[model samples]
Target: MKPQLLFSLLLASSLPAADAPVQIGSRRELFADSFLIESFSGTHLQLQTPRDEGVAFKFDQPWEGLFSGYATLVTLGDGRLRAYYRGKAVANKDGSEEELTCVAESADGRTWTKPELGIYEVIGTRKNNVVLMKAHTATHNFSPFRDQRPGVPEGERFKAFGGTMEGGGLTAWKSPDGLRWEKLAPEPVITKAMVPYKYMFDSQNVPFWSAAEGKYVAYYRVFEGGIRRIVRSESSDFRTWSAPVLMEYRHPSMQAPIEHLYTNQTHPYFRAPHLYVSIAARFMPGRRVLTDEQAAAIKVNPNYFKDTSDAIFMTTRPVEGTAHSGVYDRTFLEGFIRGGIGAQNWVSRTNYPALNVVPTGPHEMSVFVNQDYAQPTAHMRRYSLRTDGFASLHCSYAGGHAITKPVVFAGRELSLNFSTSAAGGVKVGFEDVDGKPVPGFGLEDCVMQIGNELDRKVAWKSGTDVSKLAGKPLRLRISMKDADVFSFQFMP
Candidate 1:
């Protein structure tokens, strides 16, 4: 053997054995540390900004004026997308009497239509899309989600929770079809008495059946030490929930500064059900962006211009067998969706995102935002990102590198969703679990991966065949220059 080839084989043989390969099935595993990662240089993890897709539909209806917000969008199993939001024409405290839960449907995420459900009579006309009406405080923030749990009752195919302290804590509602809703219980299902905090259920309290944890989970607003913070609770059945535990951020060394997260739209990423993504409204209290003159010119609600807010992205991985194991990563603390051009976009509680991100087209997914809040133009605007393109392992023109702790994956070929400038590129090399370079797949053997592609294959002189590494523990040492790797997976 050549001297270099002999040394390479010796190094590979001397490395310690790797831990068992993790069975990361073809789910859209994000680089959000859903798996362990280690050893990096010069690279920065970046959050991809969503491109504004313009007004999805204006909240121009008489019932849905300036105060319309707290939007929730869900994709039905039948391929239809449904949008539900609270509609109010005037500004008032949470759970105001004028608030009503409204619905809209879309064949494609673009081009929405509000069908007259005729389920509830409002303003002497039953021709509106109001699904739940006059339900005490429940309609003030009635956020609904399509129940996808196995063996869920046929009559309770859909579920929702909404109510305030005055109206009682959170109440449960069920519906067979998205249109008709009935209270699952007369009293509050999750009451204030059940939580450690004094106040609860005031904001957009969200709940969804967590398939990852095999139970129901909710992330609700609570005042902890006089700051607006979030707490999580779980339930075996929808009626009874566990006591709330304050959720803490476990960010990287570059921790995100403490701030008020008003509305936490925490839900599992549709493509990657195991990863919970929170598109929250980060409120900067007293951070005024508009002068009285500018606010008056835009005709915003009087009380809404004093503070500013924007949308942020966070994630948590609910570990099984551990109670309250949802650890939130706040590493990327920047705004995922910034307030747009005008004073209208930065008003208090504006730029709040809708619930789940749904597939809009073949290569894209969309997330809706409540924009222009408290202004005449207040409406849900649509924004989009490439599928599984939330955070990326990125490096600048100066170049950088990163490595995985140890991954045991099944599959023949490794696929990557990445992008790079014409002058920038990336290369991959495999290391034994003990950090020794594997033969034939060393950095020098890797072909320079150039261009931007969603599913590009990584090749080396030995070809792209990585079946030999299947079902075995290994590590990946990636080197890149001016490039971003959004996600990667071992494929058959």
Candidate 2:
């Protein structure tokens, strides 16, 4: 389907309450949103933060110094990992002469090394790892992704967009092997003339070929009413785009406060391709934390210490056959990942996460973050999270239970990604839409789940098979005590 037509068919409001049962088929669903939830007795949705796994690599290279930022981690078809970021030694304008793009490579996502590409001469040396140089503002934020569109030619296997409003607008860039690059068109494809926002294209303007949408979707930056927000557009051929749409946020219960979102690192979750996860930078313009003594001790840039920043989590689903929701579900308004325990971490724009969260292991995924910004100690740090574990239906020791909305399934058994304390556990039961328990799948028949596992099949007193209940509209009650249910899906 065309992107414009897909976008036009989306619901005006993403979180509309309906009485009819929703069809989920066999796709995995996370508790990150309230779409499948009806009500809760004592449980709540908890936003999960990845565990810090220490430094992945540093910007200590000659070309990639303290000012190097806007990093992106891409996993290739052959399992090789590519890390790209800007390289600048000192603070300068967006399109400064010193600004250049560099790449680092890794077989496994944990260890990264910058290869001596010797592609472009920088700092009077040809042994550097520079990819592109002398590209004006485009180098400021060059974002790329591996295009997964069905018939996308091998020459266009990779795609990218980079530019600034001051430099005209976003220009299209493409590569065959992802090592060498070239512009798809000489002129900017998305310009100010197509949008109403005043300031746009300043941050990491991310674009990707969405498998669920079957079209190219671009989520970029824009300033409306002086607040740094996000705007989205779509294209079928990667050259022309649809009318700009300002993304709105919705919650199941309350309205969330609006803050400056510096960069919306929005992309489809690798496991659940239909759900888009955004580990965004929440910027507080003047929320200063460092004192003069602390700031000077760390040798942070004088201009950057005036404010602080951290990362936040948001999700956008392909609601009701629509490709892009054009709305984000703000389930938990708090920071998904907060600043660390040092004065250096409280500095301005220091905790901004990288563009994508790539898997480092079979059971582990990693989110790379730019840490210690504006200082000589600047580097990218790796944080680890369990697979499909972004948010969860959490319950404390006090114990609580939640019931899901009516949903029809197509599988034989249910499996979950969950964690629990030794003394606590989780249980699941099936019920009708009117709250009547199903035979052999009531609360009493559930076998308590104890310990942690990425995928554990739930069992009843009878067996783990639920194929008898397949194709029938029913509700699920998740009861827990000091446990977290990250995600659940039916298996055939």
User: Which residue pairs show collisions in model 2?
Assistant: none
lDDT of 1 at 102: 93
Instruction: Estimate the overall C-alpha local distance difference test score of candidate 1.
Output: 0.84
On the 0 to 100 scale, the lDDT of residue 271 in model 2 is 82
Lowest-lDDT window of 10 residues in candidate 1? 2-11
Candidate 1 Cα misplacement greater than 4 A, ranges: 1-26, 33-35
Q: Taking the tens digit of each residue's C-alpha lDDT, what string does model 2 give over 306-361?
A: 89999999999766644456888888788888999999899998999999988889
lDDT of 1 at 337: 92
Clashing residue pairs in all predictions, respectively, total: 2, 0
Using lDDT as the measure, which candidate wins? 2
Best by TM-score: 2
- Per-residue lDDT of model 1, residues 1-492, tens digit only: 432234345445653444544456545568754245676799878788899899999888888889888889989888999999999988777777789999889989999999898887888888998988778898888889989889999889999998998887899999998778999999998888776676767789899998888999998888877778888888988888876766767676765566789899999988678889999999999999889899999999889899999989889877533466435788777788999987788788889999888999987889999988889988889999987888788899999899877776777778888889999999989888788998998888899999988888889898999898776667889899999998887778
